[model samples]
Target chain A: MTGYTAKKAGYAIEYIALIAVVLIVWCVMAGRGTLNEIIMPAPSKVLDTVTELIGSGVLWTNLVISVVRVLKGYFIAVVLGVSLGILIGLSKHAERLSVLIIQIIKPIPPIAWIPLVILWFGIGESGKVFLIFLGSFFNILINVHDGIKQADEKYIEVSKSMETPFFKHIFRLIIPGAAPNIFTGLRIGLSSGWMCVVAAELVSSTTGLGYMIMNARQFGQTDVVIVGMLTIGIIGKLMDSLLRAVEKRAIKWNWSE
Target chain B: MEHKYIEIKGLSKIFTRKKESVHALENIDFSVDRGELVCILGPSGCGKSTLLRAICGLDTEHSGDVFIDGRKVIKPEKTRGMVFQEHRLFPWLTVEENVAFALNGVDKDTKAELVQQHIDLVGLTGFEKSYPRQLSGGMAQRAGIARALVNDPELLLLDEPFGALDTFTKMAMQKELKQIRKKSNTTMIMVTHDIDEAVFLADRIIVMSPRPGSIVKVIDVDLAEPRDRNSYEFLEIRKEVFNEF
Candidate 1:
């Protein structure tokens, strides 16, 4: 227990040191006037701008909108990707049927579809959600596919010889076996979805963290831009840590000691 | 002979890769009586594992018939439980969950009762909630046995179940397995490369030869229950079995 506490303390210290270094660099750059405030606002000014945005309810509304968008797209992507991935992964016929199409579409960047999405959905929630869905879906599908493929053949045989029903075998043996990799895909998919939401909002949406950053850039409010960027970073980090905690609980058998 | 519970007739398995075909089994025939323990013993690559797979209906491409209780074996059934060389327990599931894997339609209360009974039967009573990775190899295999037996299978097929265990654990597991078999009175068909294991556990040993594998000999042991492994009688039988190799 003492060793565990010391290790946790070490981690806290390391993070504190990193924050201190960033603060020092920001202070030095601001105080020396080495870079223009328009491009690199002082940390204090950014914090003040963040306070103003929150006071006016702009920051919270935009953050919530961005989060909602991400949730909608990510939820759909997970459902589609995992189901299709399992289908393709389990059967040679299913894989062969979709392999060509998947290979063709997966390589095309989500940004590449921005014009088409805007044309179809007319800069609405659907368009932005579609873009984020595209960004996350392929990553999830590929990882889930590989994860199911990586399931031990011996276990599959055991399930088979036990006369386990097809769906039961998948639920009991294959899915749990592929969980770690699926979690990997989910983490990657979430971050990519977050990226796509920002990109979509920048391109078309009227209100979101991305829109705030872009609107601030138009008015030369560098502080607000910095605040928006930092908010996105902070939220992303929080989501990742949340996922890590969940994975720790879900994959309890991974403790190999 | 006692009533035949499992019958394999003219079984043959051929493997083809890159236009080259290798025969894994050829014209093999065998029968296991009810409540009897039969071990298919051979060197590596002698189709022992393949034969077990075929009998359990996991390998259906073989060109013969396997009948269990007068019904043709086309696919694996709930009555035939199999244990592979590896423990093959689902890592995500606890011991109790793994044992309850095949009992899909069973009620929660009955499932719990039967799973607990099987876990105790396999001497894994206290570690019911432990994950597969947390257990030792022998313990994991015991969990595997409990999982197989929880469904109350008529025939338990084991392929080198204790092969990964240490010597001491292997011997202990063998004894535990014998006890479980005796208690359940389930027909067992085991495959092993260990001659002593076959002799110690089996009522009859089927010695197999490789390269288009076929049964070379059938040695029946009239030894009594709890046969002493180091006794003179056991040694004589062991030597007689070893001489066939």
Candidate 2:
């Protein structure tokens, strides 16, 4: 039961800094002039923007669209990453072929290909998803590759000594044995997928939180910008928490061992 | 013995690494009789482990064949079970699951029964649900034994199984092994450096020579069952095995 004790330092410092910043902003703005709509919309107004967007169903629709893009891009990345990872991780030939190619491609920013994506996929959901895929694919591929490469040789020896059949050995022993590393890849891929989605929407969509921020900038709706930013941060943090929870539950059996 | 369960004839293993050939085991001929407990004892680097590993078909480049009941063993199978020096239980699996791993294709009812039977046989009935990390070293080794014995192998091969345990635990396990062998009558081969352990557990002990290991001597234990370890005869035999060192 006591395993759930929260770490005090990181969260406490972050919360304290945020609170101090908000208090300073509020005090300075209130003392400087009467409450106004334009110059620095009160923090309360930003929160009100969130509720209004939620009540009107605008928030839900845009959130779903962004989520769908992340899912499609991330799912494709996982399939490609796992297969490629296993290949490169297991075989010297595959690793040699990919080592240089991955290095060349990995350093290029996913957003830098926005112009190329626009030319190929155009201004649609496809363009946004492709961008997201570029961001997430390499992260997953590298982790999966590392996992497979480092699988315990002793276990493999054991299975080989038993004459464990080929397919069963690969599927039951190799894959699951490398699962912890695969999970690390998954968490990295999913989070980076979100970063790509935001950049994708900014380049293409008229909907999503990224588009909302762009629109708010045009109309000088500073409060809406804050709401959009907060939504992105909160959702990213929540998704990370969800992934950690799933990982813990899945690996609990290993705790004793 | 004419009724030997296993016969290793003219066995030799060499490893070619970077075009440099290393002789691991020389042309060796040794045999084990049915229902006998045999131990291979030698100093470090004498290839005691290499010879044992070759018998289990762990060495692909080895010459000669290991025959069990008139059949050659080209690879490991349910007929031959092996226990390693480090109780290699899968951390992700519980005791029951680890024991059942070898019977991957067995029917569900039979699998369940065999798993439970082996767990009890190893004196780990209450710890079936525990993982390898949760158990003490002795308990984990017992579980490893259960996993090896679950399939009812014709022969059991142990590679320094109790070398990692403390003296007290090792002695207790030695007694347990004797009891289990008496009840099951399974032919057993063990590799160890302990002279006392060899005398206490083995019906015969094969001592190996230096590099390109071959059998130097095979000492027979003529002492009767439930043999007194403190007796002068037992100590004498134990000393003879140690003298080979």
Tens-place lDDT digits, model 1, residues A89-133: 899899999999999999898888888887888877898899889
Q: How high is the lDDT of residue A199 in model 1?
A: 86
TM-score each candidate. 0.91, 0.86
Report the C-alpha displacement of residue A6, candidate 2, in angstroms: 11
| Clash count, one per candidate | 0, 0
DockQ in order: 0.69, 0.42
Residues B1-245 of candidate 1: C-alpha lDDT, one tens digit per residue: 43367889999999998999889999999898889999999999999899998888888898989988878888887788898899989888999988888687889999999998999998898999898888999999999998888888899999999988888999999999998987899999999999889989999999999988999999998888788898888888899889987
lDDT of 2 at A193: 89
Off by over 4 Å in 1: A1-7, A16-19, A90-94, A255-257, B1-4
- Misplaced by over 4 Å in model 2 are A1-61, A83-103, A219-223, B1-4, B14-23, B63-65, B70-72, B209-212
Best by the DockQ measure:
1
The CAPRI classification for model 1 reads as: medium
Q: Which 10-residue window of candidate 1 chain A scores lowest in summed lDDT? A: A196-205
TM-score of 1: 0.91
